[model samples]
Target: MAIAIAADELESLFDALPDVVFFVKDAAGRYTHANLTLVRRLGLKRREQVIGHGVAELFPAHMGGSYAAQDRRVLGGETIDDQLEVHIFPNRAPGWCLTRKHPLRVRGKVRGVVGISRDLGRPDARDPTYERLRRVIDHLQQHYADNVRMAKLAELAGVSLAQLERHFRNVFQITPQQALIRLRIEAAMHALGTEGSIADVGVACGFADQSAFARQFKATVGMTPSAYRRMTSTKE
Candidate 1:
């Protein structure tokens, strides 16, 4: 309904979050409020173009436009939950969005719609036990900067620590702790490659100390953290 000059600072705080949340409107039936993460996933230039744009507007042309019915019901006041398969233009690579959609109420009546979506592209979300264990993974990924424990992960996943481990193995073919290590370490590597310092990368990815980060980095990437930074710098 309006051009997006700037994201409301109150709301844009969520944009810094890892989860890719954006508003979905029935009238436009496309995304408004596309967070930085969502835009990156779709390889889009800016969220500004999406504001006030319709599905018809997102794609110059698309096949079928299959989601209109589901959108109509939500706009008509029925809550719907589904995993959405959204089509991004160009290559049309499939993107999975775990979504819960409901009406946007104003005073007492519906105005439009609101939906929150989390991308499920990681190899981790493939578990048959995922609906059970992956919620833990989600929680950890969300608060990765904090002190997260196996017990906390288990509580979020609604399973015992042992059960969480088994389900994580069944789905991701790795132990839960191993999965956590891989995620954190890989996150550290990404931060380093993207212009973060050795200590900054370590802190952002949850290692409590630089020595520990260097130890884990060498074990995973066969190089110390400083060495990796030097190598990356040389290549650039």
Candidate 2:
């Protein structure tokens, strides 16, 4: 079922979301609202410029127009959940957006279509080595809590460990263990800063013991988890 929200309320909620979000109406095919991140990404000086602007307005004159018609189809009670598209953004470099289109209903009736997108920009990934390393890195980034073995990483990268190590160092300039440690430390840091729990933070980042986590965290960030929390708290 479509989420029950008045247009204004939904706009506020959508704008509050951390991801870049915006919506378009079927009738006029203009932007209804764009979140702060989306606004900055589009390089608009002011919010007024974003609203009432269409993709054709923001993108270069040579961009595609088929999506506008597709948006209209979604508003007519068809749901286009997630579609991947590559387009050029403000810097004239290629970028990716995981585009989601859903029907926006008013009073249980289809009012318009709303689109949400998450950007994924990785130009270096076109190279073979980088792409292989990226697939491995993505698993670690997204599933840090899961047990990730060296064999699994090599398998995902479609190479042997020696090859993986050589290519990973060449592309990312970091060893696999270093990458894992950095990822674990960053996850711990985020958990420590945001949520107040020592053990939870330890386990979330695949750390078995608080002492080990504290040691590595201190080594990587020059501060313990508790100290990091204190730092963030002081800044707050």
Best by TM-score: 2
How does each model score on lDDT?
0.63, 0.67
Give the TM-scores of the predictions, in the order they appear: 0.45, 0.46
lDDT, residue 30, model 1:
60
Can you give the lDDT of residue 195 in candidate 1? 69
Any runs in candidate 1 off by more than 4 Å, and if so which?
1-127, 194-196
Which stretches in model 2 have alpha-carbon errors above 4 Å?
1-126
Candidate 1 local lDDT, 1-236, one digit each (tens): 23233334524765776666656463546655566665665567787766766655553322223345556678788996643333333453334345667886666776667766665545655556778765766776777767778898888777888888777766765566666776786677567777666888898898898888886665444446676566556663
Candidate 1, residue 50: Cα displacement in angstroms equals: 52
Error of 1 at 175 (Å): 1.5
